[model samples]
Target: MPNALSESRACLPPPHPPEVAKGVILDARHALVHAEQGWMAIADVHFGYEARRRRAGALLPDWGMPQCERVLHELVRDHQPKRLILVGDIMDGSGTVEETLELLKRLTESVKIICVLGNHDRAGLKRGMSMIPSHREGEFLFEHGHLPLSDHEGVIVTGHEHPATHFRDGAGLRLKLPTMVQEQISAKTQRWILPAFSPWAAGGEYTSEHKRLQTWACGKGRVWRV
Candidate 1:
């Protein structure tokens, strides 16, 4: 693997944070942040999803890791957060976790990385990285959203659904883009599901009939309210 930086890696640029809550910022690259504490939250990266699919007879291109690396590098460069909390599902298979470990070895030098294990990430936890079951930041409970949520769960922040929407770009080209779904469950509680950061994420357009669901759709370097 080549670790050389591209002189002009113009394709993947860092995104600006679109304020979702009082202190919560969602960047176009699919990162959620609590700015006051310098903590960045991300979920549903599925690092080896493509490779897993390919092995399962899906004709997918092997482009997941490099793309993830580019987005991550750009994200770190732009935000420079003190800590990065991956909510869950960082990889789909063991081979992919090994790849992720190699990437983390370099990333850990600059940013402290933490991975909250997701259903597809058992192998990653066994690798001895900074893996945790759940992380609490301020009043937020950061975890993989597959488990049941209770009233006592506090303000939940997660990613697993890979929510998205279909929309036209500035060039008028229709595209399936990732989305951030926020639902206010109660007077004092809220759950936010972030879009997948992997460029190859097999996301479907999300449509909701619920009255309380608020969505922010993102593409390229911009976010559009939906």
Candidate 2:
């Protein structure tokens, strides 16, 4: 598998020139911290993914929630952001919504949570979760990329694509890691796509033909442009 991936990578053209996010720092924990705003954001948590699969007859272990809790707790503890933004898709709509809310309640104890609902979150909304379709602050707009975004200026910070990248290590081991994508739409417009935070969500790789785009991969306790 590793050898096949390495060969495929070699056949592709080199990535475009790098673009830097001035005030946003990509977290190794599959989140982004906006230093200027004192806020941290992650997209597509998709909590209860394993439970959803198991309910459909897949014999999976019940480790998804614990893993999600650990990452989120550590992120909140480390960054101590005034607000934690869940860009979208907080629940997979198949598992127990009450269980998901329990974890969210714990998170709210430390920081304010701003949840923008995604397609998978319809159940959460019906259950009375106070979520919005979009959030705007300053020049940034936050939403789940599953819907059509209205015409807007400045940056659109969202997650729905669940961007990712694939590579092979020196030992011929193939790996698929979640990625964050930055698309330069115009001089005044940009789109920041975040990876899914759920450990079980194997996100799809980005394959756009944009001339000005940057892809950052998160894995092994490190985040780097790839």
Q: Against the true structure, whose lDDT is highest?
A: 2
The clash tally of candidate 2 reads: 0
Top TM-score model: 2
lDDT per residue as tens, model 1, 37-65: 89998888777777777877999888877
Any idea what lDDT model 1 has? Answer: 0.77
Pairs with backbone N, CA or C atoms under 3 Å apart (clashes), candidate 1: none
For candidate 2, the per-residue lDDT at 155 reads 86
TM-score of each: 0.82, 0.85
Query: On a 0 to 100 scale, what is the lDDT of residue 225 in model 2?
Result: 76
Q: Please identify model 1 stretches exceeding 4 Å from their true place.
A: 1-16, 54-59, 150-154, 168-174, 205-213
Model 2 earns a TM-score of: 0.85
